[model samples]
Target: MSSVGDLGKVKRVETDVVKCKSCGGTMVFDPATQSLKCEHCGNTEVLSRDTNVLERDILEGFEKAARFDRGEQASFKCSNCGAVVMLGADESAAVCPFCSTPIIVKEEYFGGLKPQVILPFKFSADAASDFAKRWAKRRLFAPRKFKKTLSPENMHGVYEPAFTFDSKTRSTYRGRVGDRHTRVVGSGKNRHTETYIVYRNVSGTFDKFFDDVLVANNSNFDQKKLSSLLPFALNEQCVYEKKFLSGYMSEVYQKDVKDGWTDAKKIIDANLYSAIKSTLHCDVVDYLDISTEHSDVKYKYILLPVYFSNYRYNKKDYNLMINGSNGKTSGKTPISPWRVLFAVLIGVALLALFIYLYSFAE
Candidate 1:
């Protein structure tokens, strides 16, 4: 239970900075060692985690807005691609990892809610790049140059912005479902089978609890393509620490919490519809209209690890996403014109051979 008084006390909390003891250089979170590593001295510092992941009441969070001052991290907005990038506080300059365009720091942009839990990158940069190369090798239509010239430079380890929602919903639905049936009528030439659907009015109450429904908050990237890299091990999350963001770049959430919840409900409704349909146990559905009442809804703004990169082919850019937790890769590449032509030729040859075999059999 929370009151308005609790809203006043709720504010953005900052994580402590992790510095290298051996050298004066700042330590960054390294996925390979699961510790903070210094770029200048190669010193590794271990981080302790004990915080349990908690889901905040979505309705209550709207009452108190939290904002954190930029202490040890710098925020940059890409002018060309409109990406909000966060970098180390000591470093003042950086290029946009998505478009390779120069980014300038913006002071007015308020960083969104601090992540409570983060699934750290499980794959190193070299390993992620290797996964991308292997994935591309299976894509027969991918251009030869794209695979041959593919190097690790295009891959970047990024902390992508996302929100996870939990909710208990009670939906009262009313809809019509149909089952297909066939009937034979008349005789001889008039004897024909007619297919018709038998419709029935149905109403039911559905109660469901959705634990985690992940939604993307970044708009700069292709969301559908990003979703292809799913099944991230959310159970392996740790308390969000600034050290975890040491070497990687993080994106500021462009979507607001309110909007994020709205999107979440859409996903919930779709899942609920499927659940209802499954309960009905019908082969076909003509139409279904459902009205839902959601309660005990909670959400958490978190950052997930991803190895994002892009490549250019024929003056067009194709984006790639690698799941940082499991090394799953998904991306778009330019299709080779020669490969399509060769496939067409092979199909024609096969058709000709089939026609000759049929004629000989006849």
Candidate 2:
């Protein structure tokens, strides 16, 4: 790691490269051992784990946030797809995992907020691939040929960027809700049953505290993709250190802090709406309007471990993601048309048989 001299005299250039003491070879972070392992000599070095992860005040914003100096860190820009990837200190060149374009390392600074905390990968790449394969086999509609031919070599580990927000919210809501009531009307042969809703106005105040509401800060890795790999163990996050990024590529967050907070508020509002609706205890909701105020807002810029891979079948590409922290897998798969048609035919046959039996009984 590069050391900082006098701030007034020299600019700080940080570089983190772990080397094995015995063989003098580059050592990368090993997920299996949660330590630095020399690739050439198989020597392992323990990493000092820091549990003091702190959250930053949203009001302070990015102006006071620390940034990396571009002159020393290695980065590469893909000309084909316009992806900027940051490499580990020991790497000089790599293939673009997004587009398969060859990238030569360049020493240019990519400015973005440094991560405050990171959920380091808990499993190795081979384990992630196995999890993906198991998930694919469980997809009943997936094509057999596609499943058989799925390749794990395409998988790549990436430290996807995201922002986790914490806030206390107070909401005042007004809504009309209804309960269904069934009644028998008329007499004799003209008697019939009618269903009606009893609607009433409702207003209430709700207070709640949200912790670690995660919002993806990279455009390429959107919220939908992130949500599919749900339930990350955010409590396991450690203080951010460049050593954790060894042997993996990290993405720079394109979305800024303010924008990230805006996204987080949306998620919070959605949860608040659900909670408020549940409290009403109505059979139906005509309409609901809620006004909320967020207070004591805090945010942490964090990096999540994820494995990205894609499979192409019949000229269509299906993307796959595996949670590196856990073995959970999520992805798109091509459906077998024949299997779908067979299922639909069986469903129709069952429905027809049920109707025939009912008519016969009548």
**Deviating ranges (above 4 Å) for candidate 1:** 1-18, 65-112
TM-scores for all predictions: 0.82, 0.80
Superpose all Cα atoms of candidate 1 onto the true structure and report the RMSD in Å to 1 decimal.
8.8
lDDT of 2 at 179: 97
lDDT (CA) per prediction: 0.73, 0.77
- lDDT of model number 2: 0.77
Pairs of residues clashing in candidate 2: 70-109
TM-score of 1: 0.82
Per-residue lDDT tens digits for candidate 2, residues 1-362, read 12222334333222334567999766777899999888779999888889898898998765644444444344445555665555544333344557544333333444546678989999887787788889888898888876765455666888888999999999999989999999999999999999999999999999999999999977667999899998898878999877777777676666677888889999999999999999999999999999999999999888899888877878898888998888788888899999899889999999999999999999
Q: Can you tell me which runs of candidate 2 are displaced by over 4 Å?
A: 1-17, 62-108, 149-152, 337-362
Worst 10 residues of 1 by lDDT: 1-10
